[model samples]
Target: MFKLLKYADKYKFYAFLCPVLMIGEVVFELLIPQVMANIVETIRLTDTADAAVQSAAVNDIFLYGGKMLILALCSLFCGSLAARIGSIAGMGFGASLRLGLMEKIQTFSFSNIDRFSTASLITRMTTDVNTVQNTFLMLVRGFFRAPIMLITALVICIRKSPDIAKVFAVALPIIILFLAIFAPIAIKRFRAMLKKFDGFNASIQENFTNIRVVKAFVRTDYEKEKFKKSNDALTAAAIHAEKIMVLGEPALILLMYFTITAIVIIATKSIAEQTLDVGEFTAIFTYAFQILTSFLFTIMILVQVFMAEASAKRIGEVLYETPDIKDPENPEETVSDGSIEFKNVSFSYGKGSDVIKNVSFKINSGEMVGIMGATGSSKSSLVQLIPRLYDATSGEVLVGGKNVKDYSVYGLREAVSMVLQKNVLFSGTIADNLRWGDKNATDEELKNACEIADALSFVESFPDGFNTDLGQGGVNVSGGQKQRLCIARAILKKPKILILDDSTSAVDTATDARIRASLRRLAPNTTKIIIAQRISSVSDCDKIIILDGGSISDIGTHEELLSRSEIYRDIYEAQQKGCDDFDSVGGAS
Candidate 1:
């Protein structure tokens, strides 16, 4: 947690002021006991004395009472200011921490994000940051005030009467012992509780994201059961962690009461023996309470710190993480052409076996190519390399006759537009979503792109035309409309290479064919690579590539592949017979 304090550098002035003002409050509190002692002594001196003496004592009481009032108001003023400053610093630190984490997450590649679950990251950003923020507040407000009050009060008690101060010798050790015994167990339990929190958040996210599927399949009961299990586990873990704090609280409170009772008994004996005066005894009680209360408060703060330590560690892990992919020392600023080649490239998600193994292929500039393979053939993985989304494990992926890594990641991706099978749209107007491909695009450009993707017709059919709002995830639009809009968004980029990864599956064959034909007409100089299950979709391509077991089985025109490649022939024959299951013909790849 201390490591993250760099975020508070911007609020250093407020952080410094919090403890200083808290100490001012402690000073006023400490002085109040002395004023009370003075009032008690004056009363003792005047009891049963002459009227003049009693009158003087009353005056002294009034003077001392006024002083106490002023001191208390000063303390209140300082404390209120300190609290405000502490909150400013703590909340500011949290804001900076969250911003820093988000910025780091943005720089992360797909593989880097894979290392952490989305739910866990969300918990770290929210719950973990809040815990640490609260701890920061405690430290700034009480770090100096508690220790100074405790030590100063104890010293005053000892100097006035050593015997009475001995009561603390018994109390301090017990508090220390309690902290030692409960702290380690509490840390481990809190860590477990945070993990349970992650699971609970994950359950909520998955359930809500796929609520439509659950309702469609009538699996709400199963989802409810799953959610209940997560909720129960979170509750159990929270109780397990809090039980230690609960058990320790009353034990320490009881110890404090016993210690105070012992002090009263000892002070009464001293007064009877004429060694302690009434005023002095009264002062001892005040100082003793301060000492005990400060000590107890310190222990509570320590417990909070221990529990927050778990959250701190989780947050630190992401802040210190290094991305697996990084830009080169000097990278190419632009791609030269639409030409692409893969030279013995292989890739795996992590340390697992390569899903794409030593595969080699090439596509000429301005060529419309189709890639067909059975399920698990790593079709998406192969194209991801071209944009440097995931670096090839071995060999090189070249775009525009240069290694993809030679270009800046942003530069490379800007030139290659890929529409994944599960493309999504944000909650916005139709024009708002299309402008994502080119934010400065004109009204005419949007219509042109949408027309090329066969989306303009339906988009205009709406009452608002291109201004129609698509609900969250484009829920208001049909799946085919979403796909076409995504294609239109890609087309707006006017990228050198366009990849549609089974993106047309939601649209009918006629619509798909229209999209392909429009691409050939409007984007003649651009390289187009299409991945599809239907042979008819790729039958008109300039060349077709067949993938089997992560290796190239054949590369030729559609007619040549049907004659030369047995797998391609099988898939074609299966499709011609109205069969869509490629695995039944092409087998496992």
Candidate 2:
């Protein structure tokens, strides 16, 4: 909690001003009761005096009455100002905390992000940070005022009315005991509730992000049932966590009323016995209310403190986390060329067995290469290491003749463009999405790249052409069109190396052939690596690498692999047989 508080240091001036003004308000508020007492005493005594004496007493009463009004106004002004300043400080701190969290998240490596998961990180940044922010505001607003008012008012009561003071002494300890017992229990419950919140967010995110899949499968009822379970669990946890606060607040309020009842009886008896005056009793009642109300505020502050403590711990975990991947000191700034080599590299996700086991391969600069493997062959894992997305567990991966760790991440990734297996397009116009590759790319460059990707004809057909909006996740376009657009975006980078990881799977074979031919012709100087399931997709590559069970089974040209590698020959024969069957069905139809 203390560690996260440093984000608030930037607003320390506003924080300082808030407490000072609060103190001023408390002081003026305390003085108002004394003036009220003077007015009441003067009015009560005037009844027994002579006419001139009564007239003089009336002036004293007016004087004290004006003083009370002035004191009340001063307190009100100071309180209002304090509230405004406190908001500035609190809101500034919240903004800084969210920004800081985002900045830290951006620095995290892929593995680090996987450790926390996307949904949990979102909960910590939004919900947990909000909890800590609200608590900080409460602390700043009441940290000094509550305790000062409680202590100051209690001392006055003790001096003037020992009986009433004694009642508070007992009541204060009772509230403290209640807090000591219930607070720890509430904190533990709220922490459990936060975990439920993480699960709840994950459920909603998965449901929304994959709504198309859900609808296609006709699983609306099943999804609704799943959501209901998650929602019910969250609600139960929240209710259980809040039970202590709900029950405790009313009990504390009842204590306040009970103390009021006791004081009323005692003060009334004192007045009837001629031991206390009307003026003194009125003043004592007002002071008692202040003292008790401050205690209530104090209790509320303490409750928030306990709850925020849990939130603070979650937030600190992210902020203090060390990224598993980082740039080295004196990092290389240039990639030089597109050549890549993996030297006996082995990698596992965590403590699991190696998915890329002792693999060694190299691709020459500006050469067209292909990787073919069955499902779960760690194909994506192998390519990700080139950009240092995740470092090798054992051996070195060299890019452009320098070890990948030697280059800054930005510098390394800038020279390599990859269109992932899952083609993604944000909600934007066609031109806007394409600009992600090269923000300053000219209109001609966009058209040229789109042409090479076989996307130019469809894009120009849209009513708005380049300005046509893609909608959310490019839902406005077909899967093949989305893949083409993603390919176009990557090509616009004009990178030294470009990787297509099963990116052409959605397109027809004719369109895929056209795209490959265009790439070979237009991007002749650029190194190309294609990972595909279809044998025809990589048949013309300079060399084809086939991965079998996390090892390189064979590396050769299409003709060379057909004669030498049994694994490659089998996969090629299967794909050719499937294609021949598809043609026969078409001929019959």
Q: Which candidate is the best by lDDT?
A: 1
Range of the 10 consecutive residues with the lowest summed lDDT in candidate 1:
580-589
Cα displacement (Å) at residue 199, model 2: 1.8
- Pairs that collide in candidate 2 are none
* Candidate-wise lDDT, in order: 0.91, 0.90
How many residue pairs clash in all the candidates, one count each?
0, 0
Q: Which ten residues in a row have the lowest lDDT in candidate 2?
A: 580-589
Off by over 4 Å in 1: 580-589
TM-score of 1: 0.97
Compared with the true structure, the alpha-carbon lDDT of candidate 1 equals 0.91
Where is model 2 more than 4 Å wrong at Cα?
Answer: 269-275, 579-589
